[model samples]
Target: MPEGPSVRKFHRLVSPFVGQQVVKTGGSSKKLNPAGFQSLWLQDTQVHGKKLFLRFDPDEEIVSPGNNPLSEPLQKEWKEEAGHHQEVSEQSSRSPGGDDAVPSGGDGLRCLWGDTPAGGAERWLQVSFGLFGSIWGNEFSRAKKANKRGDWRDPVPRLVLHFGGGGFLAFYNCQMVWSSSSPVVRPTSDILSEKFHRGQALEALGREQPVCYTLLDQRYFSGLGNIIKNEALFRAGIHPLSPGSLLGLPRLKALVDHVVAFSAGWLRGKFQGRQQHTQIYQKEWCPAGHQVVKEALGPPGGFQRLTWWCPQCQPRLSLDEPEQVAPSSGARAPSTQSLALEGP
Candidate 1:
């Protein structure tokens, strides 16, 4: 699945065309069709986590369930709330509206577009991807060719996007559509811990540290799939099957840092600069020294995902030794010490 960084990259890749009009479109799942939106126009776009926020001008009309055209009433409510819901440009007069315009009911899959009253139909098309979905753009043809299986519904697409030649293919359900607007939490450390203990990804976490898989828990961070975890571990030289709690503080901390740094850079469309060519994801050879990094698979760590590591470059440590020593039988944890500063 495309993780946060990848989705961020998608945002950068399509930012140039945010205000461009959609000249053509289609979806195998007719349910996702953006019909009846004759006067659609592009507005603006943003990216948060693995999701893309596309703010449209009044030109794009959403075809709600039953083909109920979003009318004037909805538009008025949208303008009133647009300021709170979307990022509006100073040069632009129209607002993107808030929760009101985007109905919370229905099959939740219909698509459409419309035009603003005064603007020259400045269009907005948002292509979003969930945990496993993605934006193919012109690459859709290549994706279709490379993986010859399943219809549109075969994949759990949260939304289907059609915007000119370079469109998006969104994945993942939109259950928590409001997460982007929520207030930020402090410290923000241990995103992995936060996701494992409090969200949907817990079910996905397998085995212990080093051996544990990242995608198993979407909560650790959004958009991680087997591909990223496998490569990241291999690069870090940690064994994939190592217990989730065993990958010492230094290694685990480094891993978390890698994910954060990598995601930040990737989302900004800087993978080439962030990742060394040898560490380039999915490549067969270690670009650093041409060492053949073998693909490891099977019973350990969910086994299905493929992991590659250069034995010469990234060595595995003895499992008998734990990465780091826990504070003590009576000592407080470092995490607790940090949290204590908040109290009186």
Candidate 2:
């Protein structure tokens, strides 16, 4: 599953499509009818934790040929190619005021060309990605080579958005649903948000649950996943199974700080097209030359996720023992505190 940083990257990739009209729609998603999205304007794009939201508003008129943003040659090629492959829907031919018309609203539409009239109902699509889910802009995933059985393997996009500007967006292995209400996102709890409240995250880490379990709780630490949990704990030299309440306030603060810093660093690496170097997540040894321990850890009756840590570096703490902060030899990353102040 993609973490917060990965989701934010997807948000950035799809942001440019905002204000483009959906010339056509195709995909294998049974949960959403793509036909209704045709002619709707891509009003806004937002990311909240592991989810992405796209707002589409109904327009009274479609993009005229004279006003089309794509150049004449490119627009002609797209129309010719799209006509051959794209799914032709009955709703595509219907007038904007027809019975299946989507509702529209005035707020959030930022047109790419000029002013757009907005009064009809607006629709929101909430996208939740599964493991290995991804979004491709202006392209489709290539078909894989045949397997041992000589069976050709080709994956269909879950949602495909063909824009009027001759570009398209393809989504794979993701869930799409039309939402009636705005998505509820708490910026203060989101790890990637500028409004991330360190004090609040520290308080959440003080719960009685296992530290690893608390770290994965989206209610408190939005955008955090198993990867961030493992790496941050290793960097902070904290045991995964230790009770958060047993960890002293200072220790909890350190864990929070590491989480924020690591998330920001990970996002930065993604933007720079650099691969992330893991300390102990799937490694056999820790940076301090100690054998890493791998085991599933979670709260009772909760989901157990695989976690890695070095026993020598992250010694388990007992309730009776005095709190001791282990020295971390892990490489330091840029802190997110300054980034948060600068705003997202």
Alpha carbon deviation, residue 147, candidate 1 (Å) = 10
Query: 1-344 in candidate 2: lDDT tens per residue?
Result: 67777776777667677778889888876665666677888877777667677777776334222211122131122211110012112121111111111213434322122222246655567676676677777777665566467866565787788988888988877766565444556667677666667877788788777788878877667778889999888878788888888888877877877787787767666666667778888999988898988998766766678899988888888878637655456534346442432222
**Per-residue lDDT for 1-344 in model 1, tens only?**
34444554555455555555555444433333444232344455554333455544445454322211112121122211100011111121111111111322332423342212234332223344323344434433222222334433233333345565456533233322221121221212222122212222232233354443443344344444455565555545555556655555555554444444433333222324343222635666665655545455544434354566655544455657665433211111233322211111
Which structure among the candidates has the greatest lDDT? 2
**Candidate 2 lDDT:** 0.66
Can you tell me which runs of candidate 1 are displaced by over 4 Å? 1-3, 16-29, 55-212, 264-276, 280-303, 311-319, 324-344
The 10-residue segment of model 1 with minimum total lDDT is 81-90
Clashes of each: 34, 5
| Pairs clashing within candidate 2 | 103-121, 103-122, 104-120, 104-121, 104-122
What value does the lDDT take at residue 106 in candidate 2?
34
Q: Each prediction's Cα lDDT score?
A: 0.38, 0.66
